[model samples]
Target: MSHASPAPAGITRRQALSAGAALCAGAPASAARRKPNLLFIHTDQHFAGAIAAHGCADVHTPNIDRLIARGVTFHESYSANPVCCPARTAWYTGRCTSESGVVQNDRFPIEPAMPDLGQWFGARGYDALYAGKWHVTGRDFTPSFRVLSHGHGLGEHGDATVARAAREYLRSRRRTDKPFFLSLGFLQPHDICYWVFAHTEPLAALPYPDLARELPPLWPNHGFDAREPETFRKNWRMGRIRQNMERWEEWQWRYYRWSYYRHVEMVDAHIGTVLDALAESGHDRDTAIIFTADHGDGMGAHQLWQKMYFYEEAARVPFVVSWPGELEAGKQDRAHLVSGLDVAPTLCDLAGIEAPPDCRGRSLAPLLRRKPVEWRDYLVSEAATTGRMVRTAGHKFIKYQGDGTEQLFDMRADRGEMHNLAAEGSSAGVAADHRKLLKEWEAHLSPSPAGRLTGTWDG
Candidate 1:
């Protein structure tokens, strides 16, 4: 017996047109009438509470707010991992970070051959346009978009060039016969750059609020621990001294809040440009717009400046999905668990195409229409080394590798994750449930490659 032939190596214009024709014909009348276009706008290091609509009275993001007003705003949307490369790859492939073997920044590159969501969309007749930060490959590789325009200066914190290029892509896409998938990637808020002290720029000149920036309620300090490890204690002492000396412990807090808000404002401004162009092209109503971030920055929260932790500031991200008439406006989804991985599959499903069998995420179409489905009861997250986090409606359980370091918090009572119930509680059953989830997750962890190349790659 012979199997069906595989798809072409890369999505060609011919394949796109043929797929478009097939999709238009075989699809139901409503599906063929006007398939929703996808405007996937994402940023780096943005938190859930950073937006005004999400009870953040300070930061102003009107474009994002408009998207929320038109579609569902997932209050509890989270990243599978809170790091940069791994999280992005997971978002692209709809696979767990462990499966991708990209658990940290040092993992460097994700294989180009990895079946990515953009390629899937391109194969299905959606015109995928990628602009701004393209961190997926260690080097350049093929993107699903027919036109791959880059190196137009999408670098740094205060650059306006990338935003301009994104606007151009939107304007240029007006005449396409197919719906579009435009990815507007922004590099903001994530520019803490403090990890490399030598290369770090001063936080001077950035606008800061007058009020003292309150640290994350759950910020872990050495003094808070009864019996901290010697290594952790040493690091903590040094970190505190550096923070105190640089006044980074003080001024940087305000600076971070300032820069983060400004970056968000910058992203929103570009979004407005695109929105105006869409309106001009008469495609605003026909398009489905989604706004989210790859991951979040700690932004000095928990005494940590970046992600790779299970804290709310780093783990949770803002997610907004909008389509004018098909979706209910101004609605918030608090019950369903949405992951960054869900994006690609959801877009494919929305376009009336079957997501490849290997894709790990489910469609959010039902949730978008306010229809009921059996949403996940426990959402999982991963980070550096081997860490597992399970978040339910009211609690968050975290287990770090063999150190036996575990954390549990009643999210409803301690939204700040201030209290750790693992040390004190009669909830052995809850703890057991968390352990069961961990065991199941552990079963899924991909085995690390063995042998000589490990040492050289550990950088």
Candidate 2:
């Protein structure tokens, strides 16, 4: 069988501009300035306390912790969604999952029509570069980057591939005077080390730090909550679901935690490799570096092992922004609620390009200066499945469609999400407020002329 040849390429700047304007009908014009180079470093399945600087002694993440020390780390930053592709799409596009339709893995490619961050930067004469996972789309779709090195397969040395490509780009940047945008996506912890290294070595043989592993406070103690939803059971991939720890061996939990830390350490090493290249190429000060993750791993929090929920363990991500003089060094911003969706406009602001007005996120540039920016007080997040969450300064509310069960917690008092305050009589107003916020948030993500719903998660 013969395949039809693709149409010829004749897309002019005028046509491209028209297409862009159509998508972002009221977006602002590009500002003229010297564009700063961007080095966006991202990882997969990274939890909030994964870094040693964040107080997780179980793993050694010296390089990442170093970045935190030299940059502004948003202590309470989180992903708009806690799944893989959806979260990543949100991060790059500055929009929610519903806007991009990348709510789950393999749902669909990121909307080609959208004005992506890289594409926006590239339009302003910055050389855009992409390396690593590229899980947002298959090879069929092309990114705005001038150079793309997408390593195929679930390669053993995926991080190495990313490091090598980033190093090369830095070396090339040394020779060129053109400003550039580099997106380095690393796939480490998501590699599933437990299944990869399970049988060959006993879980005990795996190297792990001697520090005690404290469990999250929200989950019911072992041998309780056997009535967890079937969706949670199926997604956890557990051999069996029981109310408590009696059915499962202690080795299971130990293995899970150890592998999670190990993978994080492995990626940290690769990050160091990239940082070394930057210093060697003398772009350390010139390039504004940002480190973040797509989403987080559950790691047995709430007795769940994977993401797709609104629990803190799954939703929150480590967010670090490093700019030597422009951004406050070693400062931690705790009051503001930032989202992965904010990444796009922030990157655009750094590159001196006008961010698409339709982009649902606002720039963090003002916040970086320690100025009071009216940031979103309530950040909304959604799952691949039918779940919606609203996070306020002191509370989080989740409504699971399968059962209409609501999860309410006062995050300020109960960071672990332990006590469900939804049923209590005293917290009725809080619950109602969160519900209204959830509706407003959902309306923004699901904008249409009428009120059509986007596709839902199969779970």
Candidate 3:
């Protein structure tokens, strides 16, 4: 298939095809049976453990749980970046934030030369439509997708409006003959940011009512680690911690947790609306649905509030892939390490299209099909420009470029990441191994000149 016009300034069709070729080599033979429509449902700042299916008992996400019931849940999923723009950019381009030139929120636009998810799929005869937040860049979504709705900025009800637009499109506009790639980016739980901002001032705490019983309890890792790396300590101070955490008392923190979960529930309701629309439209069975988030909020873990930290609360996110009867259902794959970078290539692989050669993500098609395949031993996630994390099966290692500080956690024994084993004599060999792995991983990244210096993990 020919492109609609010349490839953008930096992107070449040859490079795109090369990426696709590498991806296609591993796709299942059954992928040729039929092309499935793609329904990508993305949310903002949703923690991986927030959903009941993922073992969170506090939050109610029936709609998202429905997807989990019908799909494969990746228990160990990390974002490409802990910030918004970079993480979403990773999903769109199948490349890491550094490679895609969007390492931080609003700091860099997606390189025009990069072929986004919509453009790549659209060129392959799919109708790519997008609704809600397109935070990677500005309002120009022409080449990537036909914008159905860009919600009103910073308003609480915008997510509902975004869902309504997506529902309408799924019901009336989708072309049946050609496959469609519909991306629904909902903004909700992110509103907790506003809540945090509003509470920053010294406001009197409201009396705790019996209704407070509904709120989630403080996470076990709520206390700050005295031995935490200096970089992370500095980040906590630099982030909303001083403005948000320092002022709040224990009950206030619990209230904050309560508010965050409510916001998640709010978005889950919007998600249910879209899921109902898809089912009513009679296209539910044939469409491959993916549910994920850009990144996760801290949810009071380790006295943190928002993303851009390497802690599990901020870096990990929910990832579910569902294609009824075609892929494995109701199975949780906790053994494999997956990243947000894999979304685009996985979608392309499912659709039997070639992902761009420049993409760094590997397709999850084999895992979905329950086929035995060689997967990565570890995964890397970036926190804007400074922090880099590498997670193996048992341990997680984090290094920040700013102060050369480090953190290491044995995920199996310390799931809450309360202990930093990086400085311990007993864990020295493990830390060294992870550092070597990160060094090797860094060697493969193709960051732009500016991004290269913006804290690419050199050690």
Model-by-model lDDT, in order?
Answer: 0.63, 0.68, 0.79
**Residue-wise lDDT of candidate 3 within 161-256, one digit each (tens)?**
889998988888544467789998898789999988877654475555875677677678888668876666676765554765676777777888
- Which model is ahead, 2 or 3, in terms of TM-score? 3
Specify the poorest-scoring 10-residue window by lDDT in model 3.
1-10
- Per lDDT, the best of the predicted structures is 3
Model 1 is weakest, by summed lDDT over 10 consecutive residues, at: 1-10
Can you give the TM-score per candidate against the true fold? Answer: 0.80, 0.82, 0.92
TM-score of 1: 0.80
Among all windows of 10 consecutive residues in model 2, the one with the lowest summed lDDT is: 1-10
Native-to-model Cα distance after best TM-score fit, residue 399 in candidate 3, in Å:
0.5
Model 2 ranges with Cα > 4 A deviation = 1-33, 138-143, 152-155, 193-246, 447-459
Per lDDT, what order, best first? 3, 2, 1
Q: lDDT value for candidate 3?
A: 0.79
Q: How accurate is candidate 1 locally (lDDT)?
A: 0.63
Give the residue spans of candidate 1 off by over 4 A. 1-31, 106-108, 138-143, 146-159, 174-176, 194-252, 444-459
What is the Cα-based lDDT of residue 81 in candidate 2? 76
Off by over 4 Å in 3: 1-32, 173-175, 207-210, 238-244, 456-459
